[model samples]
Target: MKKQIENRSDLQLLVRTFYAKIRADQEIGFFFNETITDWEEHLEKLTDFWDMNVFGTKNYHGNPIIAHNAVDKQFDQQITSNIFGIWLNHWFATIDELFEGENAEILKRRAQKMSTFLFMNIFESRGKV
Candidate 1:
């Protein structure tokens, strides 16, 4: 059996793996590929975000809705549920591949909720486009 995610290091690894899959994906890779000039910094920020969610750490403080809204405008594409679904798929797949336990289960649930919330925010902002 795979080890459960148990620390910041595991969170970092998970985020890195998810991003690696996303950066190569055909459906939504353009947004990340064109926007992220610094993969290391972005990955660090994502690690912090996941840490905050998974471990109750307060290291992340950015507004995901605003950031994604800006990216949507920059790319002239609406962020849709399909895109979020792709992202969630990669996220859960990474978690399942790496770990299995309470933390992994919680991460999948949290990611699903987060994706829904983000998609709602993104979908609501579609009127501006």
Candidate 2:
């Protein structure tokens, strides 16, 4: 396990790589293309998101649930699942590749919990459970 705090570069790299994968993925790309026009703004927002979540920088202010709800209104469940799955996969893979330590394990667990919470909320919002 590697120290998570020392892997801020890995965090930024992972985020950028994940978004790159998303942009290229056919299933999820359409949603991104449709919803986002300014790449710089998205990247900044994502940086803030990661900073707050992983670094305790407390920079992210946007509501993920609100964003997901908007996406859900426009896209179907399959697309949403595909996006989330790929995002999680890339994120975890990046962490595994760049860091290994107790902090990394904690980060992974936190990410999983967040993912589960988001997915559960989406399902509940849709009255699917």
Candidate 3:
């Protein structure tokens, strides 16, 4: 039986497992695989991000908007909504596979919102340059 995401450890599992799918996905895999060279470090930072997001942990300090904006620029602003959709699908699927509870649902909702926010910011950033 699956369980709720209640701690940083659980977030670590979700981040690691979810990103594994992202790294393997054919359509959007290159976006990550090409940019993220340090799997261990990236996953740990993501775990902390999700931990802070889902549990109010104060350890995560990275700025996702800036990071994603940089990636979009790195790719010459080729990122599209399709990429974000695939990313969200993997995230939702991974959470469903490993967890079931309010926190899981919250994480899904938050990811969806964050994706939109990040995409919009990325789109907006393109206009500035």
Candidate 4:
């Protein structure tokens, strides 16, 4: 029986770890640099997003497509793909590091599904596939 993560603090740590990886990665760091005006607020919003998604907290209501579309409008497909890939990679890595049992598996599956959806959206938007 693995311990269940039942609070926002655990989720915040996961988000922070994911962003640390994003900041360190050369290929995707520029996206963070260009898009995030206030890093702390961005992290908080992201933590809230995950809290809502993973914990059903109902704390996040931001439009993800609009935000990503804005960034996609600025950057090309390759950059977007790199960003998404690194984003999912770091996201799942953080989850795996900090969680266990069904919770970890759930996060991993959700991240993979989101990555696939983002890739398909990118491809469809570009009329590539």
Clash number by candidate, in order: 0, 4, 0, 0
CA RMSD of all predictions? 1.5, 2.8, 1.4, 2.3
lDDT per residue (tens digit) for residues 24-109 in model 2: 87666777878899987898788777767767887789998878866777776653555678767766777677677765677678
Which scores greater on lDDT, model 3 or model 4? 3
Please give, for residues 28-99, the per-residue lDDT of candidate 4 as tens digits: 888788778898999899889877777887878798765665677678755456667778878777777777
* Residue pairs in clash, model 1: none
The lowest-lDDT stretch of 10 consecutive residues in candidate 2 is 1-10
In terms of lDDT, model 4 sits at 0.76
The alpha-carbon deviation from the true structure for residue 5 of candidate 1, after best TM-score superposition, in angstroms, is: 1.0
Q: What is the TM-score of each candidate against the true structure?
A: 0.94, 0.77, 0.96, 0.84
* Candidate 1, poorest ten consecutive residues by summed lDDT: 120-129
* Candidate 1 accuracy as TM-score: 0.94
**What stretches of model 4 exceed 4 Å from their correct place?**
1-3, 80-83, 127-129
Between candidates 2 and 3, the lDDT winner: 3
Taken over the whole model, the C-alpha lDDT of each candidate is 0.89, 0.73, 0.92, 0.76
Provide the global lDDT of candidate 2 against the true structure. Answer: 0.73
Model 1, 28-125: lDDT tens digits are 99889999999999999999998988889998989998998788778766577888899999998999899999999999998899888887777677
Residue 68 in model 2: lDDT: 80
